[model samples]
Target: MIKKPVKIQLSEGLDARPIALLVQEASQYSSSVYIEVDQKQVNAKSIMGMMSLTLLPGEEITVVANGTDEKEAAAGIERFLVNVKNR
Candidate 1:
């Protein structure tokens, strides 16, 4: 298992479009991926689960991955959350 912390960078926050894009990116990995906010965690691949979290801009979150491709999955999510903005 691998875990990394990241903050949502979008000024507009994680709206519907960004969540969908993040979900799409997460679904590509074979590892089990989850996003954690406060003490709550949800499957990154589940759109409904992600939306339920109501993540906002500048909020700190954790990306966790565990599986054969855990490292890749964690890093990918970190990269997406850290670097990608508004898409």
Candidate 2:
């Protein structure tokens, strides 16, 4: 298993539903991907779990990945976040 800490800067404050969908899609590529906010952790694969995160703008969320293709997972998510920025 491999673990990587990735930080993402939100382009704007986001609603729970859309953010959850993004995380869910990310996890589909790799189950090891996870999102952590306010000391609470959730599996990126679970939309419900990700919705529960409720992150705010400018928050540096930490993504932790542990499993096969962890590096790929992290890289994928990092690129996704940057590309989706509305700002």
Candidate 3:
């Protein structure tokens, strides 16, 4: 599996509630999503998993996408992490 590591800086991001919401929406992707957090394989597709990661601004995260829709999954997450701001 080819994994892409992206370093993102965090903003207020429309309050903390939105982060949970963002993870919820991202988890809907068909492809698998896992976060390389705390040197652990945390499932990004799960709200609990994402929340457990404690992702914040200026934090580097490695998102691993496997399966046929790998590109799509990676792109979706990439966009999310990049465009995240306090909106």
Task: Provide the overall lDDT of each model, using Cα atoms, as 2-decimal numbers.
Answer: 0.87, 0.66, 0.69
- Tell me how many clashing residue pairs each candidate has: 0, 0, 4
Instruction: Report how far residue 31 has shifted in candidate 3, in Å.
Output: 1.4
lDDT of 1 by residue, 2-79 (tens): 888998887777878878888998999999999999999999999999889887789989998999999888888888
Error of 1 at 67 (Å): 0.5
Q: Which stretch of 10 consecutive residues in model 3 shows the poorest summed lDDT?
A: 9-18
Deviation of model 2 at 11, angstroms: 4.4
Q: What are the RMSDs of all candidates, in order?
A: 1.1, 2.7, 2.5
Task: Score every model by TM-score.
Answer: 0.92, 0.73, 0.78
As a TM-score, model 2 comes out at 0.73
Q: Look at candidate 2 and tell me the lDDT of residue 83.
A: 58
Q: Report lDDT (Cα) of residue 63, candidate 3.
A: 81
Off by over 4 Å in 1: none
lDDT of candidate model 2 versus the reference: 0.66
Best by TM-score: 1
Any residue pairs clashing in model 1, and if so which?
A: none
